[model samples]
Structures are given as C-alpha cells and as structure tokens.
Target: MSHDPSGHPAHLGRPGHSGHPGRPARIADVAALAGVSIGTASKALNDTGQLRTETRARVKAAAEQLGFVGDARARALSSGRSYTVGMVTTDSFGRFTMPVLLGAEDALSAGEVMVLVADTRDDHVREAHYLRSLVSRGVDGIIVTGRSADARPPIEVPVPVPVVYALTPSTSDADVSVTLDDAAGAAAAATHVLGLGRRRVAVVTGPVTARSAELRAAGARSVLGDRMTGEPLFGDWSERWGRRAVDQLDRTHGRVDAVVCGNDQIARGVCDRLRETGRSVPADVAVTGYDDWDVVALASRPPLTTVDMRLDELGRIAGRSLLELVAGGRPASTAVTPTLVVRESTAGA
Candidate 1:
C-alpha cells in the first residue's frame, strides 16, 4: 500500500474516504478525531497559536481524513479578519472598470478573500449607502475604483479599514492608489512612429479639456520635438472627429508622413480616411494609436501599432496593495507602465 511522506496511508485523505461515515465532516469532527480541542484544530488549520509541529500535523491529517472543507466564518474569526474585500466602482460596465475589477478579483480570490462588488454610477448618496452596507457586513477592506486617470476627492468612509483606489486616483496623498500612465503610453506610441522613419507627425485626439487628451498631446510633442507637423487637432473622442481631422490635415498640412491618435477608435477612422483618399497605410502615412483596445486595433486595415494600457496589470497591483493594507502593510501609489503592441500600421513609411 502506498503511504504519504509522513508514513500515513495515502488513501486515508483521498476523495470518497472520510473518517466519520455518512455525514459531512466538521471542525469538531476533525478536532475529536485528532484528540485536539476545536480551538486548537482551528489554530492548526489557520497556522496560528503555539502548537508544536507534530500536533499541527496531527490536526491536518485528521482534517484530511475527515474530508473537512473549512468554513470561511470560522477561519475569519480565528484570524480576526473577514477574508473579504468590498470593491466599489463608479464606472460600472465601462471597458476601463471591467479590467480593473477582474484584475482585483483575481488577486483577492487567490489570497482566499472574496470580493463584493457594487457600482455607484457617480452617485454620492448611493455610494454612501453602499459603503455603509459593506462596512456593516464587516469587510476587511475596500477598493474604490473609477473611469478616469485624473485625481478625485477621497471617499469618506468612517470604517477602520484600508482603502485602495484604482484607475481614478484619490486626490489625497495619504491614500494608496493604482493609476494608468497615459503620458508614457503616448510617448511610447510616438517613439514607435518616429522609429518608422516618419517625421511631420500629426496629432488627433479627444477634447483638450480632458486630462487624457492633454497628456497624450504633450507626450507626443515631447517625443517629436520640432518634428511635429502642426498643433494638435482637439475634438471629441469619436471616429467622426478622426475623419474630420483627416480633411483638415490634408487641406492645411499638404504632406503629412504620420499620425498619432489618442485612442484606437480615432486610429481606425484615420486609417479609413487614408484608404478613401487613395493613400496606402504605412506607405503613405504610418499610423499609431494608444489604448491597444483590441477590438478596434485588430480590426483596423493592416492593423494598428498601438500602446497597451496594461490596465489589467494595474488592477492586479491595486488588488495586491489592498491585500497588503488589510494585512497591516503600507503599499504606496503605483503608476502602471505602458508598452507598445506593434503591428502592420506602423510597419514603415
């Protein structure tokens, strides 16, 4: 018969086997079978207390033998933590929030903590209600996330637990936050375009009042220096704006070699306009975009060389930071690094 390294028969803890027959095993059963008290069994399972290694091993063996699936409540009580986090976001169903939420969920779930998510829809009253509900349920901590990279007012929660912000940064320097580096993303796209031997690059993007648009325009200018074709064309974040900018650039600039857009949607419109104007992508005007939002980038003609926001990684870091804060560690604000996702759009010019 095969045995575990501990000299216990391997079959003892295998599935379809239980120390007590015909009933689900409980912590009490594990304790009774191991000749330890219920408290001791819990501490052993939780890796707490002053129990000897052999005694802890005995408890573990008993738990496996009884097939005891631990109760989260019992585990939480012993550890003085609920093993749960409240994920509150204002940008529900938006592309940005979804990735951050999923990333945070990934980290929390792996650490044996459950996530309870709620959308505030930018409603302060509703947000207050949800915050109270989460605290009342005894969540160990909370993660507040939203749609923009711009700093916003701090969430006021009376609870004595850590709060981590993602996507939308907290204006307060004291709070831990994980946010995107939009300038870096834009600069990366510019660097790639410049590398393709395309000078006289034109900028097309969202409204100048928007933080993202301003940052991206500044970043592109920073990289291109005097090589910039003209002033950035600011418009709404839409394909129509991209299309209109094409006509404007053609009429004014006369001979543009490249275009760097704020988002994939604009990039697609830019490519469409080039094709309509009998200009081949890469050959006529090398194009680049930001946000590597796959749907638009992949479907574009000849595809687009874009900058990936890497927001999933940002979310993961935010999740880890919340976990650390709950465990009494200090995690500082983090800026996610953006990388280039090269394709045929900027192949050459």
Candidate 2:
C-alpha cells in the first residue's frame, strides 16, 4: 500500500480513481491524480484560466474519475451568479410551452445551468408576481414564452437580467425574440399544393384577430395569387369551425382542388366533411394543414400534410440568445421558418 503526503492511500486500487476510503473526493485529490496544482485543477474544472487544452482535459478527466462534485452554493457565492434561469409562460396546459421548455433545457443544461418555470396562465397580476419572485431569486436570465405565436408586451423585471422571448415574441423591436415564421409556413403549404398541380385553392383559417391567422392568409395569397379561389374564411381555431368553413366554401367558392387550413384540426375537419360528401381526399381535393400536431394530423382519416413550426429549435435559439445576452452579447431577434411534413393527405398530390 502506498500513501500520499498526508498519509492517505495514493490510489484506491481502482484505475484513475484517487481518494481515501469513507471520505468524499476533493480538488486536492483531483490535482494529485492529474499531476496539476490545486488552483490549476479548479481552473480546469470550472472551465476558467488560460490552461492548455490538454491540461484542462486531463484535469476534467481526473475529476470525473474521482466523482468530484463542486458545491453549488460556494460556486454561486464566489461567482456572484446563481447559475439559474427562469422560464415564464402563459401556457397553463403546457401544450405549446412544454416543447419550448424541453428545448431550452437542452441548451441551458450544456452550461450546467438550472431552469425555474413560472406559468402565469395569462393573468397579468400573476405574471407580475412570478416576475418579481424570479428576480428576487437572482436568476441570471429569463425566457418568456406563450401559447400563441403572436407578439406580446415585453416582460418587466425589477433587476433587468437578460430576457429572451420564445414561441411568443416581444412587441418591442429592441428585445430579442425567437418566433415561428407563420407567413413562410403558409407560403410553403401554398407552394406544395401548386406543385401538385392544384388550382382553385381555398384557405380556411382561424380568427382574423390572431396575428398567425392573418400572416398565414397573406402567405397563401402571396403564393396562390389568382389561383386562390377567394378571401380566407376566418372563424375560430377548432374542428367545428373547420367543418363549417368547408360548408361555407362549398356554397360560395364552388369546387376547390385544394384547401389550405390554418391548423391540423381544421385540416382534419375539412377531410372528414369532404369525405362525408363523397369527395375523396387527395384523389379529388388535396388538403394541407398548419401546425403538425400529432394527435390531430396523425388521427385524420388519411393523415395530414402539415407545417412543422420547429418550436423546439426556436426555444433552443432563444436559450442560446439569452445566454449571449447574459454574457453581454446583443443577439438580434430571429424568425424560424417552418418545415413541411408530407403525409397520406397529400400522398398522390
């Protein structure tokens, strides 16, 4: 048996492992294993200092082998940072916010940062309370999100830590935000139908009050031009609305070769209504949808060809932008273009 300078076993008889039995491993043990100074070991472990890349890797490897974990409280005290971030959302059901949160976690976890979630459920007073609480906790930054893709008022924080908007955007041009390009998504749908030799395309979408609905209509118009049968039929975001819109289209626009819907629910409803009336999907009238929601899209009779907003990617970008802001970098707001997912609905077309 060999002993270290302090009369402890130099090795625990395990490869790359060092430290005495019945005691937690420390930085001193890491330093000894890596043949580096204690200060150098810390610098490497914390990813600081101007140590050589190999030296840092060696120190980190040694630390990992010894299972040496740093004290978060001590690190926070020394760095003057909580190493935590907050995510505020108005999506109580987590339908939209959950994917964004998961994406943010993927990026933030790489930095060893923790996230605190605050769901305000669309109440201003509740939002204010959550903001205050997060600020008081000294979060390094924040990411604001919501169910809609529309712009909302920027959140006000007492301490003014970096904030990044995800899914939902900030109305202020000065604030950094990452959002879906609804118009582009609609345009993609239009282009796809056009490529399938579809003419007389009619648009069925949600209420005009929603920015997403307006943008989507405009996008389809931009691509379809005169091929678009008539003005968009705007109602509500529901399957019933979708079914009613189909009836309205039949009475007003006559026969449409393709129907571009605002969302999966609407597309599914359109397919169902068309089927009931002896119109075979794709064979007679091709249909496309926005928001590739699995439950709605996949559950449709022939499934749906829809737009994927890639919300998770948007959240990831938002998280990275927040990190940049916390590090004093000014990241410009960005809009992510949605991708088209082809399915059975547009299989023949």
Candidate 3:
C-alpha cells in the first residue's frame, strides 16, 4: 500500500483486508496520512484553500488513496445551503412536459445541484401543499411548469428562494417566465395553406380555455382575413374532435379547401374523415396540424405536416434560466420561436 510521508497505510489498491480493521477512513484519517492538521485537510479537500500547495497536494493524495467521497448532505448542513432546487409541474405529464423536465434536469446536474420534483394534477390545494413543502425543505430555488400561458397557478404563499416559470406565463410578481410563441406558430400554419392557393380555410382547435388553442386561432384569423368563412370549432384535444371538426367543416362550408388543426391528433382525425368522405388530400384539400408528433405524422396516409414548437429548446432554456436564478442572478424571461415542419400531408401532388 502506498503511504504519503506519514505512516498511515494508503489503502489505494490493496483492500485494508489485514487485521488493522479498515475503520472507514474519515477526515481525521486523511489528515493523519497527509501529516497535516485536520482543518487544513478539510479546507484543502473542500477547495476552501488557505493552505500551502504542498499541503493541499498531500491531503488530496491521501484522500485519493483512501477513496474518500465527501458527504454532500453534511457539507450542505454545515454551510447552511441545501444546494437543491424544486421543480413543480402540472399533473398531466404530457409528452411536451417530458422534454422540458429533461432540459431542466440536465442543466441542474451539470452545475452539481440536486432537484426535487412534484406534480399538482392542476389541483389548487395540491399545488399549494407542494409549494409549501418545497419551501420548508430549504430548496435553493424553484421552477414552476404549467400546461399553458393562461394557466393560473395556485401558489399563494411567498417563496423564500428564486422561482422561474417555464412553458407558462407568470401570474405572480416573483417569477421569471419562458413561453412558446403560439400566435406565430398558428399564423405560419394558416399562411402555408394560403400559399398552396387554398382560398377557403377553417380552424379545428382544442378547448377554448387552452391558451395555445386561443393563440393559434388568433394567428389563423389574422392570416385568413374577412373572406375566411365558417365558425371555429372547439373540442377536446383528441382524434375524435379532429374527425368531428372535419364533418362540421363539410356541413358548414362545402367548398372548404384547407383546415388547420389544434394538434397532430386533430389533424389525423381530419385526414381520416376527409378520406372517408372521398376527398383527395392536397389535391382536393390540404390539412395542417401542430405538435409534430413524429409517429402519427410518419404513419399517416400522406404523412402530416405540422409545426414543431421546439419543445426540446423550450426545456433547455427553462433549465438554463433556473440555474441562473439559483446562482444569485436576476430573474430573466425568454420566448421560444416555433418552427414549421413541412411533410407529405400538405404537399401539393
């Protein structure tokens, strides 16, 4: 076993298998092995260095030989900083939310910060409870994720740490926010149909209360102008809604040449209904959707062309913002630009 200048056995490779009963080496053991004071060893290992270079190296060498891993909990407690961040999200856990969480985790992990997560299921009481619990736990920062910008988070209590909101607009004064550019995404969809020479355009959207749906509708109307006909159909975020919207479109506007759906699911429903009614896609009618769900788009009869909201980028930005707040930086907000992904669905054949 390699020993530093001191007599303590350096159990580098050889397990301290022999009789000297390898009492788990502690800071004292490292100090003794390095022939340095315990305080010096602690400071050197923690990088709180006031110690000489030679002393720091010797202490580090001793720790390496002993396979010492510092206890983060103990360090945190002693320093009065938990080094943890709390992430509070809506209960739905949709595919969109997953990427956002991944981005936040990646950023926090890179900074050596720990994260604790909670889901509120959009329940007001549960949201309050989770927020209070996080504050009580001494988390250094918080990230609140909501389903949309119009969501009203129920956290009424004041938080002691910095808080950042992602994929949602902040209703509170303390939070820094990041959100998707929904109006732009929707307008792009409408403009695409117009470019294809489709004079009659209609919208099939999710529940009116959903901020994304509202913004998308606004964008569509802005591009289509007064000549655009038919009342916007509103329904749940499901394939059934998509199918029903198509039937409604046919009933109300027999000459409809294009439709913009709230999401890929709705677009798929519209496509199925259109084919059943004997309409040739893009040849007779072009359809567009949002969320760019690859599986559905790839498998569709003509494949679906949808908007990619850049969800992964949204997550990455949210994560970066939270870290900045935790590092004593001012709260900052960001808006993610949506991209249009053209596929076979809307291609004129």
Candidate 4:
C-alpha cells in the first residue's frame, strides 16, 4: 500500500483497481438497469424531447439509483452551449459584492442555472485570466461586477455567449448592466435629515472615485442645498474610518445636527463614537446610513435609519437580464432605486 505525504493510505495507484474501483458509474449502467437502449437512456437523462412519461420516469429512476449524472462536458460539446454562468468580481468581495452576489445567486438558483464565481482581487491580469477561464469553461453567460465605477475592466475576450455587467457603469462591450440609483438614495437620506429639522448635515464617505459615492453626494447636495456643511470626509468603508471621520467632524465643525454615512459599517462607527461622546441619537444629532443591512441597523442602541439598496432585487434583476440575454433576448440595462428605512436614528416629525 502506498502512503500519501501525510502518512494516510493513498487512495490512488493501488493494485487491481488502479486505486479507484469503479468507473464513475456510466450511462451504460443506467441503461442496463433501466432495460433501455443507450441512445434512449441518453435522451432521457438529458431531458431531450419526445419520450413517453413512463419511459422517461424509468430512465430517470434508474439513473438516480446508479448515481449517474450526465456529463456536462459532453452536453456542451454536443450542444455548443455550456449551461454555466460566470460571475467575475473585484478583490474586495467582502465589503461590496457580498449582497450583490447573494442576490444574483438567489435569482440564478430560481432559474435552474449554476453560477461559477471568480475573483480578480482587482488585478487586471487576474480579471483577464478568470474571464478567459469562464469562456474556456464554455459558460453560456457572464456577469462582471466591479468594486466601483472607476474600475477599468480588463481587455474583453471574444466568447460565443452573452455577458452582463452588474453594479458597474455601462460598458460599451456589455449586453446588459444593473446598478443602484445612488442619487435617489442619497437624496432620500438628505430628505430624512432635513425632515428632522437638521440644517447642518455632515457626510462620511468612501473614496470619491466610486461612482455610487459621487452620485450619493450629489443627491445629498441637491436636497441640502447650501445648508450642507463641511467638506465630505473621505475614508474606506470601515468602522475605523467612521470613528475617525466622526472625530474629525467634531474637531472641525463642532456638533453637527445630522450625519449621512456612506454605508452601514461607517454609520455604526459614527454611532458608536456619538454615544461615547454622550450625544443623544436623533435628539442631539440624527444619523443616517446607506445599504440598510438589517443586522447592523437593528443592533445599534437606537435602531439606525438607513437607505435600503435592495441588493437582492438588484441581483434578481441582473440575473433575469442575463438569462434573457442567454436566451437570445435583446440587450438591456436596469437601474434599481433605493428606499429609506426609518428608525430611531432619524426623527419622524
């Protein structure tokens, strides 16, 4: 017996069996069990047309009993379509793409489609590799998600399939695109603060290069007009940035009556800092955040008021768009609007 490097019994290279006992239970076994011809079995297993219900049932039952899964590779080779869809994301998956991905996956699952996810870590070379890999894998469609609008996607590879871009700005090369209406969301946030009778509102946001951020700022400006005070404090979407930004706001501008955070994480940080400084939420200074992630909003001392980006909806729409494109439908783009979730962070009156 051969031992693996870890001293475990090696499962490979064994005598008589070549370490593996059975050929991955082929269609032949299914056919034999079903008492059907190989061609009939193949058709039944692939769900091709024109088979009687009873015949299809027997073939399916036999294949299931034998643990026979049709070869995806063979199907792709014969049909010229790979049933897989590829989702390519930038390196910062945890911060931004998590909700978007979840939404996309949920939508795809409902459509009986499988998604193959790849991470580029924001590297152009890696992005290119993954794009090529998806094409080589024979994926029927693709979804490219960028961290921000400023992301210059890597060179496009010609593939015999449709590609959808999500959460990124429109690309000349894409068939469909979907993103949040950041300006509307930001305006909503500003309106929430103004409704609370706040005249001076500060903003803590991520890099200005992010299109979503820029749009949000613009929206806030539209509502607040010249009453919006202080320069936007820029930082990454982290609690640390939130804390520091709040500290800076306090030092520079004194007690601002309202704050609109770039995201939930930053909002939480700002809220924490406000509590530490003995400021009463909504009473002393109202706070609002974007990306109304429930856990973060509800867990705060006073539940946070936030803008719901409707990430799941974004995903479903994108998935539907991609599926439509894959089915030879026309190219399309969708802009999902965000809604405000009112909580203790903002005053109702």
Candidate 5:
C-alpha cells in the first residue's frame, strides 16, 4: 500500500475515508462526502468565490460531520495569505490595548483569521524583534497600538505590508489610524453640563503637555467660553490630582457649579472630596468624567456621567482598515466620536 510521509497507509487519507482510521480527514474525503468536486469543496471551505448558498452549506455540513479541518499550508498556498494577523502594543498593562485587540479580533475572526499579540512594553529593541518575527511568519497584516492617544512614529517594516494604528495615531499622515475624537467628547460633556443650567464650570484634567488633555480642554473651552470659571487645572491623571484640583478650585474659583474631569479616577476623587467638603453632587456641583472606565465609573459613589470613547469601535474600524489595505484599497484614517453616558452624577443636575 502507498504510505504517507508519517509511514502511515495513504489509503487512510484517500477519498471516502471518514478519518476514523489512524489518519485525519482530507479535502478529498470531504469532497467525496459532499458529492462535490475538490475545487468546489476548496472554495466552500475557504469562503471564497461565488457559489450557491445551499451548496456551500451542504459542503460545510459534510466537512463538519467528518470533523475535517483544512491544512494551514495548503490554505495559504491557495489563498496567498497566512490567515494570521499581528497586534503590537506598547501598553503591557493592557489598559488600552485589550479593548482594541478584542475588537480587532471580533472583525478578523469572522474570516477565520487568527491574531498574534506582541507586547513590547515600550521597548524599541523588543518591538523591532517582534516586527521581524511577524514579518518572517508572513502575517497578513499588523496593528500597532499604545496606552495613550499621542502620535507616535510609524513602525518600520523592511517588506511592504498593511499596517493600521489604533488609539495611538502614527505621526505620518499617510498611515491609516483609528482614534478617539477627544475634543468632541469633551465638548459633549461641557454641553451636557451647560444644558443642566450649571454655568460656573471648572475644568480639571491631565498634564498640559498631553495631546488628549490639550484637546479636551480646548473642546470644553470652546463651549464654556467666558462662562468658564478660571483656566483649566492641569495636573497628573490621578485621583490625588483630582482631589487637589478640587481644593484649588475652591480656593481660587469658589462656588463653581460644575467640574469636567479628565478621567473616571479623577471624577471619582472629585466626588469624594466634594462630599468631604460637605458639597452635594448635582445639587451643588455637577461632575462629568472622561473615559468611561467601568472599574472606576460604575463603582463611584454616584456612577460618573462620562464620555464613552467607544474604544472597541475604534479597534473594529482599525481592523477593517487593515483588511481593506490588504485587499489593495486605500482606507482613510478614522476618528471615532465619543458618546456621553448620563448617570446619577449629572442626571440629578
């Protein structure tokens, strides 16, 4: 009998074999079971080419019945793709990367694509090594991401391949990036506070040097205008900073009716300090936060009214962009607009 490379009888993998005998099911067996040509079986299995829906379904059901799985090498040869994607991130903590990665996976999994994550921890050497490895493995595409919204240098790849940035944008305008519209989100928060008749608004946010901070402050400023109480209080992105900013606002801009915080942590801190100082939220001061981080926002004394950055949607768009690029289409950079989630903090006001 003819033998396979593994010294097994080749008949075990031949047509009409159910794979029950010491060997895995092959496409030939699936084609025989489905009563279709090998070519049609391949097209149906790979989800390529136009075919009658019922015919494809029958082929898939037959393959499933036989527990057939196509070989990676053969699939790659037929489709000219490894069916693998790589996600490289500097955010080892996964604070921002996780959501984006999950969203990208959601989009890619539909096409049977697999994602390989490489956490560089902001290390250039490690990132370069990961890039080289991914390229060598012949990944179909790559997605680059980071912890912050700042623009970073484009990742260098020796061979031309599709690369998309998520959350963190690439410095080169030519590269496709999907990111949050921080300014618009902050503006929405400010508008909501204003609509509640809280005119004396104060802004507390992250470092003045941060692009997100700058954009958020600008967005709030554009709306608050002369009604804004003093200038924005820029500090670190922390609860301590938030509490301190509240104290500062009390001393410098007393009796502010509302505060727009940089993040959920800051907003929670502001709420705590406000209560300690005997100020009732919504009644005395309405607070709004950026980044609707569930751990902080939902657990706050009065769940924060915050901007939902829609990070998952951003990642999904980034994934779609990479797919388009891989298909030889030039997809434009996308800026996902944030949505405001109203909760007890602002609902009472």
Candidate 6:
C-alpha cells in the first residue's frame, strides 16, 4: 500500500477519501481511499483473476465506505461479459414466478452470478423494451415466466444470451422451457377418485377459455372414459363455481359417485354443496382437487386430496437448465410432473 501526500494511511475509510461535498463517489475515489492504483481498484471490483487476496479485500472495504458501485457498463465493454442474468415475468405479484425466480437466483448466486428481474405485465411493448435493455447490458442469460401452463411467444432479441421460459412454454421449438405435466396431474386426480371404487364421476372446474382448465379436463376424461358423466361443468376459479357445478351435476347426472375439481377452492365448494344436499363425502361422493393449496385444501370439511405442482422444484430445474445453457451445454426442454397428496376428501371410510 502507498501513502498519500501527508503520508497518512490511505485504506482507512472516509478519512482517506477527498471529494467535493455531496459529490457521488467514483472508482477513482475508491482507488485513492484504498491506497491502490485505479487498475487495482478495477480488478478488485470486477473480481478479475490473479489479484492479491489481501489487496482485493482492502479495496473492497474502502469501496463499501464510499458506497461505490462498480461500473458494470465499463466492465462489460472491456471484458465482453457481464456475470448477470435477467429474469422477465408478467406476474409481478410473483405467484408462479416467485419460486422459479428464487430457484434460479439461488443457483446462480452460488456461482457469483447475480439476477436482475423485471415485470412486463404481459405487455408486448414493455417486453420488447426490457429484452433490448437486458441484451444491451450484456446479461449472460434470461428466464421468462408467465402465469400458467401455457405457451407464449419467444423473446425477439437477436443477442446470443440464452432465455429459459418457465411455467409457460414458448411457441418456438428452438427456445427451451420448463413446465409441469398438466395431463399427469389431472390423470392422478381422476385415478384417485376411481381407485376409491367410485364408478360414476363428473368434472368441476374453471373457465373454458383457460388452457390449464382444458388440459386438465382432457386428462380427467382420458382416465374416466365411459365412466365420466356429462361435459366439464365450466365456471370461474371460485367456490361459488364449485357449488353451482355440484348442483348442476346433481340435476343432470342424478347420482354421481365422484368428481375431479380443477383447484382446491372449487373442491371445497363442491364438498360444501354436497353436504347441503345431505351427501356424505367419500361415502356418498369422493372429490379430488388440483394444485394442493394447503390453506384451502387442509381447511376443507374433509382435508382435500390434491396434486402438488412442486413449483419450487420446477423453478430449481429451470434455474439449473439456464445455468447449463450459460455454461455452453445444449439447450434442452424439460417437463416436471406433479405429485398426489392424499387426504380425507378422497379417503373411503
């Protein structure tokens, strides 16, 4: 370490820094404060290899006192790399995106990589702008996420960075994605109902326009076959819809033995409606739901038998996939299957 004009210790902290009052701290300020050349400060900040461990530590400490943020733009220009990942999502509320983004961030953090996330609210223009900005910033990769089991358009940026779509797939086969096995989840629900020896079955679920609802309905249909009664009783993703659907099934199908619900809220409603009509769950009727939302499932009259999407694991896999791509591995698509969490709702007494 070198001394200043007064021969005072240069790496102490604020005392070593000199600047116009309230002026923003700069790299030069960090170097002066750390008793190092600008080149050493840059190396320490960027984590460049072959740096002296003690010198780097001293420089970092000075930078903290100065509140200096390394110039990412300058580093990117000089090294042609930015050890950062950008995660884009429409779900700012994080619902589906949280677990996936956290998984990716945690995995990347262990490798000294950082993640920058943006919420586009599914806006086309905003999505384009964020992609362009992240590309220009030289992010190593990106992860795109949407609300449900569906497909969206690919990121239109021309940059070389890899983008992994999570929850929602990309319509482009060239782009990689990680999603749940929707069909398998529905099949499991239907099978559980059938396994309880309930031959007469019906479907109760959300809107017809939702791809998730359609796929789940198809999965249940494939399992129920001749045993499935009536068309899928489509309604909103709510308890009211579930209760109304039960009434509709009772009117048309007369004596249904079981029902597969699209979500726990609907399943809970169905159970309430069945009891109102003097039907005992699992004895007179067995009901199963998807997306084992514990708060709703566990609070049901009889604890619900539901499918666990394992979203955190899906997020982890998605993170792993993006890291693999960043490390020069071939981009490959993957599908994660959900699990069945059995409870009293489908348990035959």
Q: Which window of 10 residues has the lowest lDDT sum in candidate 5? A: 5-14
Overall lDDT per candidate, in order of appearance: 0.86, 0.89, 0.79, 0.78, 0.89, 0.84
Candidate 3 deviant stretches above 4 angstroms: 1-7, 11-25
Q: After superposition, how far is residue 234 of candidate 1 from its true place, in Å?
A: 1.0
List TM-scores for all candidates, in order: 0.88, 0.85, 0.87, 0.80, 0.87, 0.80
Which residue pairs show backbone clashes in model 6?
none
For model 4 the TM-score comes to 0.80
Per residue, candidate 4 scores C-alpha lDDT tens digits across 255-323 of 698999888878888888888988878788888888877778788767889999887788778888888
Q: lDDT score, residue 81, model 2?
A: 86
Q: How well is each residue in 1-349 modelled by candidate 3, as lDDT tens digits?
A: 4455344444332333211356556777777667778899999998896778888988888887776776777888897778888888884657777777888888778878877989889778898898888888788778788666684543565656777778876876556788899989988988888998888888889999888889888888899895467867889788888888887777887678888888899899888888988998878888898988887777777789899988778877877787777777885677888888888878863
Worst 10 residues of 4 by lDDT: 7-16
| RMSD vs true structure, all candidates | 4.8, 3.7, 3.4, 7.5, 4.4, 3.9
Give the per-residue lDDT digits (tens) of candidate 5, residues 148-188.
99999999987988999999999999999999999999999
Clashing pairs in 3: none
Model 1 alpha-carbon miss at residue 212, Å: 0.6
What is candidate 4's CA lDDT for residue 44? 90
Winning candidate number (TM-score): 1
Global local distance difference test of model 1? 0.86
| Model 6 C-alpha lDDT per residue in residues 1-349, reported as the tens digit of each score | 5555453334335543344446656888888778789988888988886788999998898888877866766766776668798899988836567877887777788767788888998788998899999998889899999887778878888667888998999999998899988878999999888877888899988898988898889999999998898888889889889999988997898789999999999999999999998999878899998888878999999889999988888877878788889888985899889999999988863
For TM-score, candidate 1 versus 4, the one ahead is: 1
Which rank order by TM-score, best down to worst?
A: 1, 5, 3, 2, 6, 4
Full-model lDDT, candidate 3:
0.79
Q: What TM-score would candidate 1 get against the native?
A: 0.88
